[model samples]
Target: MARKKHTEMSFLDHLEELRWLLIRSTIAIIIVAGACYFIDDYIFNTIIFGPKDPNFITYRFFCGVTHFFGVDDTYACATEFKFIIQNTEVGGQFSIYLWMLVTAGFILGFPYILWEFWRFISPALYEKERKKAALFIIVSSILFFIGVLFGYFVVVPLSINFFATFQASSDIVNQFTIDSYISMIKTSLIASGLVFEMPIIIYFLTKLGLVTPVFLRKYRRAAIVIILILAAIVTPPDIPSQIIVSIPMLILYEASIIISALVVKKQEQNG
Candidate 1:
């Protein structure tokens, strides 16, 4: 019997395949989230609240750097800050917990999700390209996890330290809502994770002829400006923090250019 070609599948068949993919992905997330729910203590107190503490690893690392550089009167070396994270709404904490579980589930099940996503798209690719499913998942997952670590360690600590210590007057206290704090964490992690996928995005765009290395190089300066703006938005309103955040992004952009060039080269060779 002859194997059916991917183009032979009807629109309904595609929809049915998509439905199953969604079902499988959702079930994977739910199962992981269910396990995360049982570890509420660790999730809430340790991971979630860790950056709030002056003794957190990120804070300590920065403090060490500041001390090593002999920087005086900097927030990095400060041992503590005055702030209270309160749940103003009755369901605020509960909502945060649920969201945390879902976030954890997504992070942990990201590889599986990527695999399922690749499965959906692989049918349209050549057999040689289809063989790259494992490479695609591995590289994407590594980039995502690196982004998460960067957000949690660098961006989160910088923002938390800056905001927790900033004040208009001595009389004004920093009382952040629980939801607000969680939102900061979520935004940092998710945004950075997505940002780190720029190279992969560029690869696909290049493959589809939507983007070229020449175009990227031509607009490189504009991209740098935009990246700085994003860094400032995510991090504290300080030059150093923004620079630190922007550096990785600039590196990602450069990497993306290389990836795009390589893709174009491969296409040229094949053609």
Candidate 2:
């Protein structure tokens, strides 16, 4: 592909610049993570355990929906979940702290990371395109944070509650290890943030001619099925939960379609 030139920096020089970009990004994450380790109380009790509590915003919202529909069997309305998280290994707590801080750092440093990514790509874009990348970073960062919030508030709570309550035999008790719980939440947050980059992904794909409006339109049904399956994998296997998760993704898919169309049009104009 032909690339626009910013009129500076050789290939090796660019790599050197990239190395510094990475160094800065890493430094930012470590600084934020250090703060996270200190504020373990807020991170653990308020943010991490917030979903474990029945008063989570998702449960309350769904409970209200069920009440409005006059279907009174809304289990989400319950004020308590019957489950215990236990650490069977001595190192489990330490592992959870380590991973939790790492994930926290990633979330906190997302914007800086995006900025570094932009710095790498911007030189290859037109001056106008480079200027627009400021909006890209801002939008990408906001979408990621929104996805993190959604995962924490909706997906994590539902999955934990469902798994804890699931009982095929009376002989089994629901005792999740601290590491296991942290892993679940961490996966949810990271996966959600990555998935929410739909429009940006599509923009690049469009630029490379890898995706187009017609292709997306033709595969619309297949995309929906794939999205539902992905939703099921990420959230509890319940239909409502999957649908709720898939809705935002579908909206983002549509947004990606629009973004792809715009990029394609711009390319055609330049050509």
Candidate 3:
């Protein structure tokens, strides 16, 4: 059947289109998740549990950096973690496995999801704007993947290093539940991925007249404060770690402002 024009579609039709879009996106995630099951061991052991090990690549890199700088901090150069991950519930491991499979699926299948979303929205866009669908998907996916990596490599390690070694008393021991560990990992990866889409989000919001470059500039200080707070929340409570996390986010905010400006300029030119 031929697709109806946007103007010809009723509210119910638009809702139906959105429903199918979600259905297709869900199916794509499930398909990718099925493939992820094959590498479950690697995902659980190497990727998820890697940060718990003191010898993980991120820790080693930081250790090397500290050595080069002659820093006396043993936190970076530690050879072991003080915490143990345990699953108290019989089905906890199974539940976590399924959750991670879906998470991995969504991350890997992000571009396809974007394609489906674009197709749904493309009908409402001008021909020239719709032509940029591939660019949008590519850039969005790249940014998301980069953000995931940042979360995994930079944020996760710092968090694990801090919490794993924190000592309230010599009598108390830290035994983290598997559920909590996976929850942290999931939140970090997903949050970072979404945060990195700031520029793309700003671009669309600008086009929709909801945001402006002047507004972003005027509230630059507020944005910076919020970014720092977010950085502190995600990273270890250290100046260096917070700075490391905040820098990329600050750069993205500035870039969003520029993108918003260009979008407004183009809209004005067309008008």
Candidate 4:
């Protein structure tokens, strides 16, 4: 069946469509979240708190890298870090469980959410463009999951290790609240997931003639500075952590430029 072109939708009609789109997306998320609630214990203990262990995959990989370089085991190679996590408020643990379920739901249902969003916007696009929905959802979901994994396996581990090991004095013990720990994980995962949407964002901006590859290239230096700042903000304060985070973001920016250029070329050819 062919999709009907919606070239004559009124403002209220558009609003109504948007409302349904949001409603459907929210329903999908809630359904997934309901499932997540049942497995909250495993998710929280095994997955969310995995990075706190010194023997996490990320730590082992870094340790191996340091060994290959024949460097002293003071930096990434050192893995002996101990920290305790506590819940201060009465409902803190329950709140964390609920929020984690919601977050997991969002992550798991991301592709469906994208599908609904694409459906909502497709009528505004050309028939040829409407056919690209599958590609859009697949690529976007892949990028988002990659970003989530990077955050979980790299950023979160490095951050936990750094903070766990770093001490102002021997008298002070690091007892992080459950809220703080979960907040850091949530921020890392969500922020990286969104950051990895750079290409998609660039495509839309280019389509709207609000951005160009030339413009991106011209501000490449400034962009690097901003990336570094963002990296610093997201990851641990150390240079290595910042560099690790910044490298991927820089790559994403460069990829966005290429994507924007391709979009412009295609637009020109079509016009």
Model 4: residues with Cα > 4 Å off, grouped in runs: 1-4
Segments of candidate 3 deviating more than 4 angstroms? 1-7
Q: Which stretches of candidate 2 lie over 4 Å from their true place?
A: 1-20
Best by lDDT: 3
Candidate 2 TM-score over all chains jointly: 0.92
Give the C-alpha lDDT of model 3.
0.92
Alpha-carbon RMSD to native, per candidate: 2.3, 2.3, 2.7, 2.1
> TM-scores for all candidates?
0.94, 0.92, 0.95, 0.95
Better of 1 and 3 by TM-score: 3
Give the Cα lDDT of each candidate: 0.90, 0.86, 0.92, 0.90
Candidate 1 structure quality by residue, lDDT tens digits, 1-271: 2223756789999999999999999999989999998897998899889998889998888778887888765688668879999999988878888889999898889899999999998877778888889999999999999999899899999999999889889999889999899999999988898899899999988988999999999999999999998998999999989999999999999999999999999889978
Which prediction has more favorable lDDT, 1 or 2?
Answer: 1
User: Which lDDT tens digits does candidate 2 get at residues 1-271?
Assistant: 3556456778899889989998998888988899888898899898988888888788888889888998885476777777888889888788888878878998989998999899888876777778787799999999999888878877898897678767789898778888788889999998998899988888888877899988998899999999999999998878878888899999999999888888888888988
Model 3 Cα lDDT, one tens digit per residue, 67-180: 899897798888889888999999998999899999999999999999998998888777778879989999999999999999999999989998888788989999999999
Give the Å error, residue 89, model 1.
1.3
